[model samples]
Target chain A: MNPLLRVEKLEVVYGRAITSIQGISLEAHKGEIVALLGTNGAGKSTTLRAISGFLGLDDARVTEGAIHFKDNSLANRPPYLITKLGIVLVPERDKVFPNLSVVENLSAPVATAGANRKRLEEMAFTFFPKLAELRGRTAGLLSGGERQMLALASALVCGPELLLVDELSLGLAPVVVEDLAQRLVEIRDKLGITILLVEQNATVALSIADRGYVLENGRVVLDGDAARLKSHGDIQEFYLGGAGERRSYRDVKQYRRSRRWYG
Target chain B: MQLAINIAVLTAIYALIACGYVLIYRVSRVLNLAHGELMMLSAYLLITTASLFSKTPFIALGAAIFLSLCVGVLVYLFLMRRMTGEMVLAAVLTTVALGVLLRGLVVLIWSAQQQNPAQALGWVNHSLPVFGGRISAAGAALIATTALVYVGLFLFLRFSRYGIRMRAAGQNPLLAAQRGISLHVIYALAWGLSTLTGALAGILISLDSGLDSTMVLIGLKAFPAALVGGLDSLVGALLGSLIIAAAEVLMIYYVDALLSDVVPFLVLILMLVFRPWGLFGTREELDRV
Candidate 1:
C-alpha cells in the first residue's frame, strides 16, 4: 500500500544558516503508527515542523526534498492549509490554549467541513474520559498529564487523516506516558489515522509503533520493524539502555558514527 | 450630579477607544499606535459621507462607519500582513509610521479645517435633562454605544466559535494555526473590529464637539485607560476609563482646569510604575509587549 504520508530526502534549514535536518526521509502508511526515534538535535522536531508546514515561523524552510500527503505537496503551504489538508500537529509543549477552557479548546479546531464535530468531540471524551470531567476548567490550571490529554483530545477534534505528534512523553511520568502511549494505539486502531510520533523515549515509542526509524545527526541511521528493532544490539546498547560491556567514553562517538541498518 | 454626568461621558469616550487598543493587542500582540489617526479618519469620513448621503443622515453615518472598517482590514492586508513573523517591535514601529502618514494624509485631504459631522448630517446635538444633570444627545449616545459594545464583545468572545478561536489564536498562534485556524483571518478580524469600535468613539465624540487633527489626542488619551485597566481585559478598560475620567474631572474642578489634559498621563505613569501589567493583565505580559 502507498504511504499516507511520505517525506522524500527532506532537508530543512533554520534561519538560513543552520541545516537542522539534512536529507532526512521517512514515511507512514495508512492506519499505521510510525515512530521516528531520536535523541536531542536529531532533527526529529524539524522533520515534524517541515511536514506540518510551520517551518517559516522559525525562519526555517524546506530547502530541498518534498513532503507529500496523499498527493498534495506541503511546501509553501501555511500551517492552517496543511491542517485543512488533514495533517494536524500536536506539538510537545504549548499544545493547548492556556486561557481557554477544555470545552473551548476542543471546539477551537477548525475541523474539516462535513465532519461531525459533535461526534468527534464526543469520541474525544470517550477516548480520554478525564477530559470530560475537566471540561469547564481552564487548560492552564490542569496538571501536566491532564494537559497532555487535553492537547491530544483537542488534536483529535481536528479530524486529521494524519497526526504529527512531537515529543509525546516528554515531561510526563512513566505511568502517564504508558497510558498515553496506549491511547495513541487505540486512537489509530479506531480512527485509522496515520500517526508520525517523534520521541526520544524509544521504549515507549517502540512499544506501540508498528515500524520505527532511528535518526542521528540529521540522518536516518536505522529503520526496521518495531519487534526486530527491540532486539537489535545497537538499539539495546544505545536506545533501550540494555546490558552491555560499557564502551569507553572516547570510543562512544566512534561507535555511534559507525551505526547503520535497514529493515 | 453634573460632575457625575461629565465623568460618565468622558469614561464612555475612553472605554470605547481603549477597546480598539485592547482588541488588536490581545490578538496579534501589536500595539496599534495609529489607532488615533484611524479614529480621526473615521470622523473625517463622516464629513465626506455626509455630503454624499445628504438626504439620508443615518445612511451617511452607516457608510462612514462601514468605510472605517474596510480601511482597518485594508491596513492589515496591505501593510501589517507583511510584518507578520518579522518582529513585534517592527510591526509596532510600522503603526507609528502609519500614524504619522495618516496625520499628514488627513490634513492634506481635509485641509486642517474644523468640520462638524453633526451639522453636515443635519443632526442637532441637544442637551437633555437627566437625573438633575444635563447630557448632550451625543454624550448619551456615547454611553449607550460603549455599554452595547462591551456587552456585545463579551458575549462574542465568550460564546461564539470565532471568538473562542480568536482567544485561542491570541494565546498560542502556532498551535492555533495547526488546528486549522487562519492567523491572518483572525488578525484581520481583530483589526476590523478594533477599528469599528474606534470609529464609533470618534464619530460620537465628533458629533458632541467638532473635528480636526486635535481629535487624535482623544485617542491618545484612551491609551492610558487601556493600560490602566489591563490591555487585554475589557472589564479593565472600563474600570481604567472610569478611574482616569474621575481623576481628570475632579482635578479640573478642584485644581486647575489646565490639569485636565495632564491627569490621564499622570495616572498612566503611576500605573506603569506600580503595576506595569495593569489591573488584570497577566504578569508575563510585560515580556510579550
Candidate 2:
C-alpha cells in the first residue's frame, strides 16, 4: 500500500543562497507515529515547515523537492491551502493565541471542509481534559504544559489527517512530556491519524513512535524501526548516552572523534 | 440639560467615525490617517449621486455608501496590499500620502466650495426638540445610526466566525494564516467595514451641515476618540468617544469655543501619556503598534 504522505528528496533553502535542508526524504503511513529526531539546527523543523507550507513566511522555499499528501503535490503552496488539505503543524513557539480564551483558540481554526466542528471540539476536550477546565481562561495565562495541550487540542479541531508537531518536549518537565507522549500515541491509535513528530528528546520520541529518523545537519543520517533505532550502536553511544558501558574519559573523547569522522 | 444633549450629539458623531479607525488599526496595525479624507470623499460622492438620482434620495445615499465601500476595498487591493510585509511606519505613511492625494482629488472634482447635500437632494434640515434640547434631523439620525452600527459591530465581532478569525489574525497573523484563514480577505473586509462606517458619518454630517474640506477635520478629530479608547478595542472606541466628546462639548461651553477643536486631542494626549493601550485594549497592542 502507498504511504499516506510522501516527501521525495525535498530541498529547502532560506532566502536564495542558504540551503537549510537538502535531499531530505521521509514517509508516514496512516495510523503511524513517525518521529523525526534531531538536535538543534538539524533541519527537522525546516522539513516540517516545508511540508506544512510555512516556509514561505521566512523567505524560505522548497528549491528542489516534492511533498505529496494523499497523492497530491503540495509544492510551494500557501500554508492555509496545505492546512485545508489535512496537514496541520503545531508550532514550537507562539503555539496558542495568547489573548484569546481557550474556547476561542479552539474555535479560531478553520476546520476542514465538511468537518463536524462540534464533534471535533468535543474530541479535543476529551483528549485534553485540562483544557476543558480552562475553557474560559486566556491561553497566555495557562501553564506551559496546559498551553502545549491547548495547542495540540486546537490543532486536533482542524480535523487534520497528518499532524506535524515541532519540539513537543521543548520546555516541559519530563513527566509532562511523558503524559503528552502517551496522549499522542492515543491520538494516533484512537483517531487513526498519522503523526510526524520532530523532537530533540530521542527517549521520549522513540518511546511512542512506531518508526524514527535521526536528522543531523539537514540530512537523515539514520532511520529504522523504533526498537531497532533504540538499540543501534551509534544511537546508544550518542543519543542514549552509553548503552551499557561506563566508559573512561579517554573512551568518551574517542567516541566524539568517531562521531566527527562518521558525521 | 442643553450641555448634555450637545455632548451626546458630539459623542454619537465621534463614535460613528472612531470605529472606522479601530477596525482597520486593530486588524492591520496601521493607523489610517486618510480616513478623514476618505469620509469627505464619500460625502462628495453623495453630492454627485444626489444629482444623478435626485428623485430617489434613498437610492442616491445607498449608491454613495456602496461606492465608498468599494473604494475601501480598492484601496486595500491596490495600495495597502503592496505595503503588506513592509514596515508599519511605511503603511501609516502611505495612508498619510493617500489622505493628501484624496484631499487634492476631492478639491479638483467637487471644487473647494462647501456644498450641501440636503439642498441638492431637496431635503429640509429642521431643528427637532428632544429631551428639552434642540437637535437637527441629521443629528438624531446620526445618533440612531451610531447605536445600530455599534450593536451590529459588537455582535459581528463577538459571534461571527469571520469575526473570530479576524481577532485571531489580529493577535497572531501567522497562526491565523496557518489555520486556513486568509489574511488578505480579513484585512480587506476590515478596510471595507471601516470605510462604510466612516462614510456613514460623513454622509450624515454633510446632510446635517455641509460637505467641504473642513469636514475632513471632523474625521480627524474623531480619530483621537479611537486612540483614547484603544486602537484595537471597539468598546474602548465608544467609551473614548464619549469621554472626548464630553470634554470637547464642556470645554466649548465653559471655556473658549475655539477649544472645541483642540479638546479631543488634549484628552487624547492625556490618555496616551498615562495609558497607551487605552482602557480596554490588550496591553501587547501597544508593542504591536
Candidate 3:
C-alpha cells in the first residue's frame, strides 16, 4: 500500500540563474510502472540525475525539497550510497564500461551492491535471454537495442526494489521499442520490481505505464491513469502535437527538423 | 659465467625497482616522477640508521622500511592529495619539486659522502664460485630478496582482500568506491607498498656499490622497465626489467660503455613506438589518457 519511492517538491538548478526543475513531486507505488513524460529540456533526466546523486553537489544540487526511497532520505546521499540503498538508475547514455565484456558489465552493478552474484546472473538472464547468449561479447559491440537490454539487465542484477530507467526507448527501432515495452511489463508482473520510467516517447510509455505524469517546462501539467492521460485532449495536444488527424505530415516533419537541431 | 651472474643480479635489482614504480602508477595513474627520490631518501635513512646502530644491520634495515612506509603515507596525504587538478602537468611539477626537496634533504642529512653498511653487518666481501665465476654475498642477497619480494607481492595480490580491493581501485575507482572501498585507504596502501619496495631496492643497490645522491638515478631505470612490462602488468615489469638490464649490460660490454646511459631511454622510445600500451597493458587503457 505504501509508495516505494517519493519525491516531494524536488527542485534542481544548474547554475546561479538557470533552474532545470522548478518544483516537481512524484511517487512510485510498489509493483507499478510510473512514466514521466516531457518534451526536451523538461527536467526529466535532471530529476532522475538528482535523485540518483550522480550530479555533483557543487555543479548540480537539489535547491529545495527532498527525495525519499523506501522511507530513507536520499537528498544529500552520495551516488554510491544511493545505489547501496537499492534504487538503481540505468542512465540514458548507456554508460557501460566499453572494455568490459557483457558478463563483466552485468557483474559490476551486482558486485558493487554486494548481491548474490550467482542469483543476480540467473535473474538477469531470465529477463534478457539475448544477454546470456552474448555474455562473452564486450558491451561496446552490442547494438543499440542490445545495449539498452544490457543496461537494464545490469541494473536489475543489483536486485533493486525500485528501478529508475531514463529513456528506455530512446534511439531504438519501433519493433525494438515494442519488444522492450513487453519485457518491462513482464518484469513488473513477474519480479514485482517497481519502475519509474522517464520517456520522450509518450505513446510507447503510456501503453505500458500504469500511471503517468505529463511534465512541461519543468512542471507537472497532467497526472492520471495511463488510459485517461492518453485520451486527454491537453496531453494529446502537447505531446502528440494534436488531438485527431494522426499527427499531420508537416507536424511530423517539423518535429524531426527540431529534433535534428536540438540533437 | 661471470657475465651471466652480473646480468642476473642487475635484472633482479631492476625488477625490484620496476615493481615499485608500476604499483604506484597503476593505482594513481600518476607517474610519481619523484619516486627515484623516495628511494634515495630511504637509502639515506638506512645509511644514517645503520651508522647509529652499528651493531645491528638487520634492525636498521627493518627500521628503514618502516620509516619509508611512514614517509610514503605522509607524502600521499600531504603532497599528492593537494596536487589533484585538471592539469596533470601541475601534479608532475609538484612531484618534481618533491624529488628535488628530498634529494636536497638527503644531502643535508648525509652530506655528499658515500656510505656503505656492509661492514656494519660484519659480512666479509668474499665471492663464492658460481657458474664459473665468483658471486658475492651481497649479490646473492639481492637476488634472494628480489625473489622473496616478488613472490610475496604475487601471493598478496592473489589471495588478500586488501590486495584485490587495491587492484579494483586501480581498474575503476568509482566502481571501487561504490563497493565501499575507500580511495584514501587504497592510495595510502599503494604508496606505502611502493615506497617500501623502492627503499629496499635503493638500500640493496647502495650495498652493492655505496650510498650517494646519484643512487637516486637508478629509479629512472624503472621507468623503462614499467614501459616495457606494461604499466599495469607486474609480470611485464619483471620481463621489462630483465630486457632493459640485459640490454644495458650487453651494450656496456659489446657496444660502447658510454651508450649504456641511453639504452633504457632508447628501449622506452622503441616500445612506445611499437606497442604504446606496453607489452601487457590493454589498448583501451591508452584511450583513458
State residue A28's C-alpha deviation in candidate 2, in Å.
2.0
Q: Write the per-residue lDDT of candidate 3 for residues A1-263, one digit (tens) a residue.
A: 66888898888877656898878888899999999999998889888888877423236678788898887998856666777788778788735656557876765553435567688779889989998899889777999999999888877766777888899888999999999999989989998988999999998899999999877778776788899988877677667666565666666755421111110
Clashing residue pairs in candidate 2, if any? none
Model 1 chain A scores worst on lDDT over the 10 consecutive residues at: A254-263
Q: Which number leads on DockQ?
A: 1
Each candidate's lDDT (Cα)?
0.92, 0.89, 0.79
TM for candidate 1 is 0.97
Q: Estimate each model's TM-score.
A: 0.97, 0.93, 0.77
Instruction: Summing lDDT over every window of 10 consecutive residues in candidate 3 chain A, give the lowest-scoring window.
Output: A254-263
Candidate with the greatest TM-score versus the true structure: 1
Candidate 2 residue B69 Cα shift, in angstroms, is 1.7
* Lowest-sum lDDT 10-residue window in model 1 chain B: B81-90
Native contacts retained by candidate 3? 0.08
Give fnat of each prediction, in order. Answer: 0.84, 0.59, 0.08
Give candidate 2 misplaced runs (Cα > 4 Å).
A15-17, A55-57, A243-253, A256-263
**Residue-wise lDDT of candidate 3 within B231-269, one digit each (tens)?**
888899999989998899899999799987799989999
Task: List model 2 lDDT by residue over B1-289, tens digit each.
Answer: 8888888889999999999999988887889999999999999999999999999999999999999999999999999987654567889999999999999999999999989999999999999987888988999899999999999999888788888888888877778877877788899999999999999999999999897899889999999999888888898999999999999998888889989888988998898889988988878777854
- 2 against 3, candidate with superior DockQ: 2
Q: Mind giving the per-residue lDDT tens digits that candidate 2 earns over A10-100?
A: 8988878899987888889999999998789989999998998852347788988788999699978878888888999999999898888
- Superior candidate under lDDT, 1 versus 3: 1
